[model samples]
Target: MMNIRRAKPSDKDFVLDFCMNTFEWGDYVYRVWDRWISDPSGLLLVYDSSNFPSTSKSIPLGIIHIVKCLGDILWLEGLRVNKIHRNKGIATALLKYSLNYGINNGIKESSALVSTNNFPSQKMLEKLGFSKFLEYRYYNINLKKYRDDCNVSIKPDLVFSKKLDIKISQFRDIFSIQEYLSNPEISKFCVSKYFDSWRLYDLNTSLSSLSSFVRNKELLIIVNDIDEIVGIAIVKPSGKISFNGMPMIQISYLNCLNLSIFVRVIHLLLMNYCDVNLFNNAHFLLPVFAELEKILSTKSIENSDRFFLYSKFLDTTSNLSSILPANLQ
Candidate 1:
């Protein structure tokens, strides 16, 4: 027999053993295990298998985690199944359980990120009714290499030649920032959501949400000589350590007036926000733009990987049978 239950502290070793090689670089499950287990707004589940006598203990076969974000978004992540138990419906069961939990808790939508190369996972998500909403690529920067190759003292010629008078400063004006984000053009660029700390939140431009960013001092804005907002960058410490034990940072969202401005903003961020002795690397989750790609290539920065954001709406008024299979229903 098999069943799913809340993950316990005792399941750490067993779960981590299988999660070690989830990808070429390994997995992040271990890094987030504690946070996921302790998160009150999230659920960490383990699939237990029992085939022995009644007195024997059930063994963990798989794991899944779901986090409730602002705007009633359910962020699903960390789905892993033991190699020996592959193709036995373990992943499907875990996903269904998490989805049901979200529905019961008033979650309106569900989202997950998958690698562009993971066809199996993509097929599974399609089978489960998720649609590919957006594509993003990770542009990784090596702080030490970047600092050595590029002179940060001088501004890029592109921005300097344009003679665009701009300054990079911390953004705190919640009202104005909210108003700026509400523009249809900006909204289209943001794609109605923002990535932070590896989780996605609806870009509703609500005062409360923007205030949280302000409190953390993670919001940066580019303003012209007249102090009009021209660009924005949402960056924060990832609370994760690299393999070499250095700290990691994430560029959650970035938008600028043009390619030159965008490049300038990135250089400014490297000079001001990223301290080579402090941060080891930064990961940028950016929308797929051809011009941006060309500029990044010129800077010797290559995309590490591409990912697809999948989303599905869960109707609260409908029965589970309408969306889930009979067994799950």
Candidate 2:
């Protein structure tokens, strides 16, 4: 028979190896294993054989983690199973365990992101009553590829032209962004309601405990001519490190006034960043906000990957309409 239990420190190596080899997207488990095992607001569970004792300890066949976020949200992540143990109901059992954990812990809801192409995972989430309420697109900008194009000198006419002095500044404090998100106009456009400044604070404060490979990051904000905050982007570093020891920077959480402004800010940011050689490349996670959908729909870029968010509410009265935007007329 199989046994499900909280993962221990000793199980870290096995779990890391299992994740690194079994996953094709990237290996993130090892980066957060230490923190997950010790987190007060998180759980790391493993499925293994305990009834049939072997000469050595039974390795974990599957593993899953759940983190408590702001707004009493339980975010499920890093679900992985050994290839040899596929179709053994391990994933389902793990999900049920997560539900029970949430209920007992007083978390009202849980959510996760699944790749659009990964139908099996989507089906599994749907079977468990989760609803796919939102979609996000992830785009990777190869600084090396854009380096040549961005290296050109500014045009003399443009240099003398009068324009809004839009500038990008790194957010040193989290509360500034928190206050910005509280605006009804901006909050309504956000993809994750629970993702506030407090969440960003928690991320910076708690992520250090997870591993040294991942760096604490900050947000880049765009200020307009009159110094009004217009757009913002998150600069996060992933768990995986390159062969040369540089970690990839995820340039996500992007929200701007318009496509033209976004393109200009991104180009300016990239130009300045490439001069310093911060990372090998950067990724942009695009949420389907108001006009962004139409802007991208008109473009022919095909290199980005898409992911969908599915949320399951433990409270019976809760509805997807509460969190989702109304259909456009």
lDDT of 1 by residue, 126-150 (tens): 8988999898877767666566555
Best by TM-score: 1
TM-score of each: 0.84, 0.71
lDDT of 2 by residue, 56-160 (tens): 667787888887886577788878987767787888777877766676556788888888988989999999889998787666556666565334543433322
